[model samples]
Target chain A: MSLVFAGACSHAPGITGRSERADPKLREEFYRNLGRIRECLEAARPDALIVVAAEHFANFFMDNMPAYCMGMSDEYEGPIEDEEWLAIKRRKIPGNPDLSKRIICDVMQKIDLAYAEEWKFDHGIMVPLHFLTPRYDLPVVPVNINCQGPPLSPLHRAYELGRTLRAACDAQPERIALLGTGGMSHWPCTPDSGKINVPWDKAFLDSFIHNRREDLISYTDEEIFADAGQGGFEIRTFLTVAGATEGSTGELLFYAPIPVYAVGCTVATMAVE
Target chain B: MSLYCIQKLLYQLNRDPYTRQRYHDNFESLLEEYELTKEELGAIREGDIGLLYVMGVNGQILMHYSALIGQEWDEYIHAMKEGVKSHGPVRAGIYTLLKGSES
Candidate 1:
């Protein structure tokens, strides 16, 4: 099986940007779990990592948002925000256009896909990379679901995307790992930025960790916004992972609501047989 | 939609260093490109984070702009709250004031 690993983690910029502001104990625990992800990801020894992220306005915007996009550049650079502000230095990351094209072509057979030869790394990507591949050594295939804009892609489509991605990864000779990174339930950038719906998040994670397709994709946007805040829409990332790892249950490596980080941060991996 | 234009301006400013430079060096010229409302123009000109927040700028874009303008994290959050108080709840967009979160 070329699909060696599949996991998800939170990619809140505050996880790195406002690091010191969060409670030390909670913050360390979160970091430690992220480190655990790094360990597991390294143990898989993937040739390329596909990060299915719900990016902010950093790249795709309302002007022309794509429901799904994959990076197709041989090289990309990022932390598009001020390096000092994001607390991650801007550096070029390697990409494998050949691998991307093969995956994109396969996904296109089952899904309408958008390919970008040019992609800049925003916190949605950089934050995860900072922990999972701190050296920037692995060739990355970046995927984004427009979680920021309204009228998002349907939940079923997101799940289908995971299934499609799995087929594509299985076709490849290189060992591939998938990491879906996003927030749980927290109000970021609003006045209620620190508010977190712990119960709602735990419920969602329960559905996700168990790979319960119906429960994972059953959430209505209105309900997510009302209960989990708009940020909760990012569950699409987790949903995608669930879609890819269907029939295989998952393990929750870590989960906590660190208010300053503006997310019920999560780290977990789905078993891939 | 003037809000779209307003957001477009901030989006360009936040994403592109060239646009950021143009905004810093010849803001009027750069501002001319976007069809903004007088209030939006005034808000941008004054770096009124509160007013901009109240006008319904997406927090993701606005957050980077806040950092660009050198507002600390707490100050940025405060500005959004202050915006709710001064200009009323967010005029539009998905980022509502979260009921009683209005400070």
Candidate 2:
């Protein structure tokens, strides 16, 4: 079986941690859209869910940061921040090592990759899971791109990673759902945390939802920081999703610049071709 | 720059219960394990969120550290602002690269 569902969304900690701070109407709208996608994901009935996220140093540090990493564990735990801080309780999330090993092996054939037996879920995965897998029943396969550190893999490589992931998932018998979660254009964690570039985010989404490969990979890191701020580098995750569904367009279910959430809150899904 | 070590320390403190225990039990001894500059040492010792930001700590790592140390969301953002105001901008890391650029 191939990918049963393909989608992407934002995973800013503020989505859950500071939920009450955002405009209630906008938050509900954003969440309703998330619910829409969740319904779509469940309808697909995937055997495993692949979350391609940009972790914030929860597990991988710069000490030995792999450009790309995939989880290969029977069990994983997440929301590594204080329980009150993230507003998500810590729990042991189930994983399918067999499926992960198969995907990792297949992905490695085309691109250099790292496989981790142990992974701690930061908001990157936890926040999204809170909305999509509230019951936490689906087996998860976590992928991390080095969006936090410098010398990240080229955007094309991220795209290639996605392409390879699609192939790997296609080879397996189990149905899979792949979702990339990251901020669009916002500064997180600094004093400029609430700053958002709406036009920049919309333009990128336009390219992404349309699956414009060339335009998506054309951004330079310099340009991203100047306009989108450091947090914008997480575009790699989006790029990977776009790469997976290359030639297939996506649907933008929701988008709103929620300053308190510190991200242009987004929920979108791509057609798995 | 010992920035790497500084972040490494915070990274450990944020994720590792053992490290957090050491951080609570013998803070000084735990601090000694990292190759931190005097400024970094002072920043960690005082839990000066602003100074740490100014010293070029990545917000992703620093944010967790702030939460671990009990700084609320608004307080963390304010701390980074104060850090830039007092220390005159981030000295290194991604921020410097962004600030240093002609763009």
Give lDDT: candidate 1, residue A143: 97
User: So what's the TM-score on candidate 2?
Assistant: 0.98
Residue runs of model 2 more than 4 Å from their true location after superposition? none
lDDT, candidate 1, A65-156, per-residue tens:
99999999999899888887779999999999999999999999999999999999999999999999999999999999998888899899
For the second chain, the TM-scores of the candidates in order are 0.90, 0.93
Off by over 4 Å in 1: B96-103
Instruction: In angstroms, give how far residue A233 of model 1 lies from its true place.
Output: 0.9
lDDT (tens digit, per residue) of candidate 2 on A1-273: 999899999998889989999899999999999999999999999999999999988889888999999999999997788878789999989999999999999999998999999998999999999999999999999999999899889999999999999999999999999999999788898888889999999999999999999999999998898899989999999999998898899999999999999999999999997
Top-DockQ structure, candidate number? 2
Q: What is the TM-score of chain B in candidate 1?
A: 0.90
Best by TM-score: 2
Prediction-by-prediction clash tally: 0, 0
Residue A241 deviation, candidate 1, in Å? 0.5
Residue A260 CA error for candidate 1 (Å)?
Answer: 0.7
lDDT of 1 by residue, B67-99 (tens): 888889999999988888988978877775344
> Residue A155 error for model 2, in Å?
0.3
On a 0 to 1 DockQ scale, where is model 2?
0.86
